[model samples]
Target: MFPTFPHRKWYEQRIDTMEELEQHVLNAHFPEDAYFRGMPSADFICISSFYRQYLQDNKDSLNWSEQQVGIGVTMSLPEVGKQQYKESSFEILDYFYKCLRELGSKELSFNSIAYLAQHYGLPTNLIDFSADPKISLFFACFDEKEWFTDKDCTLYVSDILWHVKAMMPSNQTIPMGYFKHPTENRGMTEAEADEMMFNMFTTIDKDSSETVTPKIELDEVKYSARIHNQKGVFVYHCDDVPFDRIMHTSNCNDGFNKVFVINKELKPKILEKLNNEYKINEKFVYPDVEEDPNLDLILAAAEKTKQKFDLP
Candidate 1:
């Protein structure tokens, strides 16, 4: 029913209970570098809002010939050159960085700025994921807006090593040894792993190609309270294609993609278990920050109360 390879495969299953979900994840036996993302709707593909909007904004180009369309199906930017594509992506990003600069957050790398923009609700070619599978499930189960309450959700389990291999350009050889897997005799430090991944994703040189690569993780140089609380890491879309499309079309024999479609009726149960049993409620995922006026006032009041109680 699904594509398979000797060492990797693409598979999906309907998950009903927490135990079943855990067992399914355990069966996969993902490497330590695996990352997970949960979406409110199972139908949702792993595409960033920016690219999604870009496609929508230029719907007519969808019919253009490959040469005319240039980048790919989803990317319809004028085929003047790579500069045009870079500018289109960077326009809003530069504006975001400028705003942050005005607010005194200086010296932020481009990826750091882009991460912040995504967190603050600005669209970019980045998708959020968690190191913890259950946390991703928490996001899948809980939707405050009730927009997708009746919809089945999806939990994505991605193996970074294979994902990168699948996304690499046909002519380029992936440096598998650069990142030492947890199972390897010699393991790379967390910082080293992050730096290696960050460099791989961000560096643009003569060797880079238009072919979509597996989404690479970003280094969280900027401190985001919500991101930190959520164990948030990001996968950068290096090309114009949507993430799931790349995964499905990847030719790598060892590339693996697994998604668990959560039952709609069981969402509440899952959410309750996550919140009460696992203690992963909204507050736990989004810690209070000074930028929130309401939280700031609440914290000030609590501090005053503590001071009053301490009076001798």
Candidate 2:
């Protein structure tokens, strides 16, 4: 089914049957650097749950900022938009790392914490993809609950690494302010804040000839049981824009990124084949393991982390 709502669809091809969907995957040539993502619906834009939630939460504030200010009406919230959110994301991430550290994860990197948080059902800026297209197919056919056949699902294919390397803007300097300590008593003076912000964000020009890349492909090191089982990889815009938005605005031509829209009617058939034939079901994709001991502590840490951020 074609989506009734307005959404960005790229090089979208309709797959009418299970055989056709398999044939497309079989016949198509995926580059060595390619990554695949699947969604339960065609209309879903490629964005992280955290970013999506943030946008939804501040929809009114965002709209207010976009409109012209009128007499006697004040802008109640600080201007909230994509850029500001991106800046705030860094601080939030630092808090997650600190939280994990507090829970005895001293050696874990920020990226590792991000992967763990995502797998554990926490909202994060990381978007999951798989190196194997078959895994993507399983996800497209089955939502976590059950077979999602109400509408057409999508399997998005792209060499995102290639796209970023070839098309992403380079050498852009951005202000990423410092995260305040929990026990900090005094507020930073204007000059101190400016200097700290400048130093933190200005490290990019380390080499005059080198340029910074905007997209981060998280390392392939297995961070969690589920992540390893799923052959999971993650991609995120360093600037915090949706990956689709970055691809849309780039100068590159089509075919680099493709979307296969599986027929809604064929979802059940596809899922069955995936399970019985390919052995790519939930049991296979999600490995059974004892729950993380710090699950509650981590959750509380996340709440504490968010509370520390003074986002408007």
Candidate 3:
């Protein structure tokens, strides 16, 4: 569905040093804000950091790449294959919200349920981004051990609401795309209605005329206290999108955005600057970083260790 053909070279810029990386990523200014304000898109522009510049469409899902090799699940299935990907997502969301409602948040909507799932680490295709460049870089530099090579990381800038929808799938050939759900006087196509049916979840962007409230724009939703603090938003992804695909294919004029391969050695320096200068340590990123969530994480690890050794 990336039908836009600008006929140009791939939009990737490699930053060889931390000094330059910082200026472009952390310190750069948007000269194009006036243009951005006029677009029909929601300002879903955000950054994501990956340890490796080449990792694309690396999503957490029912079938993550780590488990795919042995399972023989390929992305090449027919329409049913498409439906399976879409349906499983809906099923997991429904199950999670059902359990929550039983526990008493009676008014959860589908969008809220998806947000909860992603933040709590349940498998879904949503990827995280932040309006703040530093927040995105923090993730890139997180867990020094997970930081590979000379401390190299990549920063991605994307307008997810634009690219993901324009590139959304219409059939098995494409396999990954968004379903058009109308909120106005217009009637739902049978397929669109199905997408909204039982799960009732939608990231609906309404037209100016629609009387029904638009589905929540994920970019605007404060899904949780932790995400709210991190300045995070979820970029909905379909199974077939490679992490790198957005770089070369998005049709928007301003979409070339920025690309950088940060110096590996700079990881520690940046991490230190962030935690000490901006106070972006465990407490900020993890929310009460030293409290319940982190302790729970440590406890879970301890239980796993004890189980492995058959310790009493």
Candidate 4:
């Protein structure tokens, strides 16, 4: 789940002093846009003051290292882009619309504009709040898919931050690494590992209608799979085509692919036993189609290979 802003004044009051407040802010490494969007100048100053006071009062509960507070007050502001409108309400609404337009052009999927509004510190539930009604209407206009994802249903808020950062003239967007530590030992595998891994990757979600469903189907499956031998599992079911390919296609950047760490060691003969005894083939059902034994066999082989090695 995504982290949320503190709601209680006591929680807010616990942080005190410039040094303490600065340390908290640095540790957050919060995006510039999120920081400014969540707190305007007056609010930012107030929060910082309160945070310092809180920290001083509750020193027993908190401890900081020199490395943790290395930087201070170098925080950047969220990109509001050009402030075309003078009215605060209208400016906020227009900013949101601009974000939607930009993200839409990039073919990004979202779940809820509400999350974006909140991230920007706009009044999310404004009917009872003092914000303009138009702000709420703006959020209502976009579909949930425009701002949310299955992971957190939070309006793809992180993507919005990324988009804003990418738009900056000097901002260099670095994609965070998506792999586990390379040196971690997963275990050994036999000669037929690749084929087995592939089969396992294909079979794990064989019944997944979203993966194998035809494009014309109302709920089509648009995914691919990869076996992470080190991780010992099949990483499947990605939303984006490129991401799916990144996992399945050979020779892509190693960082973007999903990894499955195998947790157990097995002999080659175990593959045959799993195939016959588990009837693993029966589980490899294609979306919107009858079962195919050949595909099942292939998938079973991959799964078996994925399980070839166990990590301690």
Candidate 5:
């Protein structure tokens, strides 16, 4: 099974200025040399967004989200029973793969499949994150005033080096058996991996197979340039415990879980600093736009793409 989580919430730091945040990020423990001594690639920051920290995505935690998706019956509704939710989650995944196969996606991994679904606005267990620190900052300041009742936003910066080392104590490269990595280490074909995942994903207890984390092989066919532009990575949920839970398995103190508090009053200034000084924005983060930086806004305001976007 996968390693357990380190649920020990450490003392969080609140920085008043972007300068302080930059100094914290700029001074992080990144190995200076790489090519000379065969040093591992330097650790980079990864970020997860929340309108409010209390409303986190706890284990496909869409069930725990307080936000509304604007659909009639609250598409945000959770399942009635835990068992029913698990069963339905697996079934929905199977349905998604079937649709992908029908649409000519051959031998796709779970991460790739889920990323595609997320981009198209489907309700899956997947949550999105970015590797770019500035991009993370962009998300931190993005419209919390409107969507979250004028609430302050949060940005969680995890050091990837600490995270991977914690997850794979022996080998930092060990894959979490999503769809790409199976437990048996048998050289199974993609279809075989699919079947194996179906069994593992549907399991109810602490079975060994339940820990698999099927991700893209070599991550080359990782399915999205929009994702690539952000230097994105993901963690998919399986029957076994997730990587977050395992971080607290011991008194293991790692640097990957740093939390930052961004005040709502500073948002306007922060946005200006990021957009004008750092040159980061919706276009930089989402890179799929033709030319307009405000294409998302344009589309939403237009009659043609507005309804399709489910805009009110």
Candidate 6:
């Protein structure tokens, strides 16, 4: 499936910048360490991009390898012999995807693929979603120690309306499946939702800040609960659960559930207090806050919490 395009000429013409370098890293299909074996960054981006387009366009027909069910995506371009590297990289990605399909529905995890790429001395080009071109996809690979088959992974898209309504200060919108309710059909007022989300954030921020080292895991529950209560629905691994019902789940006491109630019920009042207490837009950035260092801290906290919950 390799194209005979003059990829080398393209590489020589374009000068890579820090921004491009970061994008290349973020859009990578595998781990950062995987392609570190003297592979030109530009070449990697080109190859990864080629494979990504291929798989996305042919998702239905693609299959995993005999034991691999996950596919990695990324891009790279380097000076000198760009065409050869581009061709070889495309072949590698194409083969990788074919291998996953042949594996027959095995489990896979993002981290697993990342580890695999790292193991092979290939740059995985894993993207930091917290950064610019936030939605860019990237390269990856498989590692026995960290690899999880495709069957093990669950995909969830976040609700857009939920975020708009929540008026989350960070304005961190989840991708399509993150919500339990139908964001498209849910008729919620954006103003009210934002107020509710603000309250939830303030509460969680207050709680976390009070601790010497904030436990983001505990705050996420609070955050999730706030969204659930305000939206009247909470999403769990793509399942839409009513806010009240989610409260009854076995793990509801995990602190997240409890905070959910607070967020919905008291968010408005909380927001009012915070509005009076702090300057607007001072606490957190929105819209284009992904590059904000403060927002990065919040994200770091969230990641730490994820680790605490042992969530994949």
Cα lDDT for residue 250, model 3? 48
Full-model lDDT for every candidate: 0.59, 0.59, 0.45, 0.23, 0.43, 0.26
lDDT of 5 by residue, 1-312 (tens): 112112324524566776776676434542321000000111111111111111232435434322232222122223224454356445544565565555455676555655555444444444454555666666667663465425555565543233223343133245455433543466665456655545453332323232333243445333455566555544343322233333233224544455555556666777787889877776775665553333343222232222433322
Q: Tens digit of lDDT per residue, candidate 4, span 52-142?
A: 3233444565433221111231222221211221133233334453554544322212212222232223421111110211111112222
Deviation in Å, model 4, residue 276 alpha carbon? 38
Model 2 segments beyond 4 Å from truth?
A: 1-10, 64-83, 146-148, 167-220, 238-241, 249-254, 290-312
lDDT of each residue in 211-256, candidate 6, tens digit only: 0111123323232222112111111111111112212222322222
- Model 1 Cα RMSD, Å? 11.2
Cα lDDT for residue 262, candidate 2: 83
Q: Identify the runs in model 3 with alpha carbons over 4 angstroms from their true place.
A: 1-9, 31-80, 144-151, 164-223, 252-255, 289-312
Whichever of 4 and 5 has more lDDT, that candidate is 5
Q: For model 3, give the 10-residue run with minimal summed lDDT.
A: 33-42
Model 4 CA lDDT for position 107: 22
Provide TM-scores for the models: 0.67, 0.67, 0.58, 0.16, 0.55, 0.17
Write candidate 2's Cα lDDT for 1-312 as tens digits.
111212235467889975687678855677786779888877775767676657667665554322222223222222446556665555666677777778765466445666666665556666778888888878887876654558798888876554334321231233222323212433655445544443333222212111122222244243355676677767644433346644444434656667788888887787787788778888777655453334465566667665675332
Off by over 4 Å in 4: 1-157, 160-298
Residue pairs in clash, model 3: 56-243, 57-242, 57-243, 150-264, 150-265, 151-264, 152-264, 168-177, 169-176, 169-177
Lowest lDDT sum, 10 consecutive residues, model 2, at 205-214
Candidate 2, residue 60: the lDDT equals 59
Q: Summarize candidate 1's per-residue lDDT along 192-228 as a digit string, tens digits.
A: 5555554564443223333322232334332566666
Question: Candidate 5, 185: how far from true, in Å?
Answer: 15
Evaluate model 2: give its lDDT: 0.59
- RMSD of candidate 4 to the true fold? 26.9
N/CA/C clash count, model 1: 2
Which residue pairs show backbone clashes in model 1?
167-213, 167-214
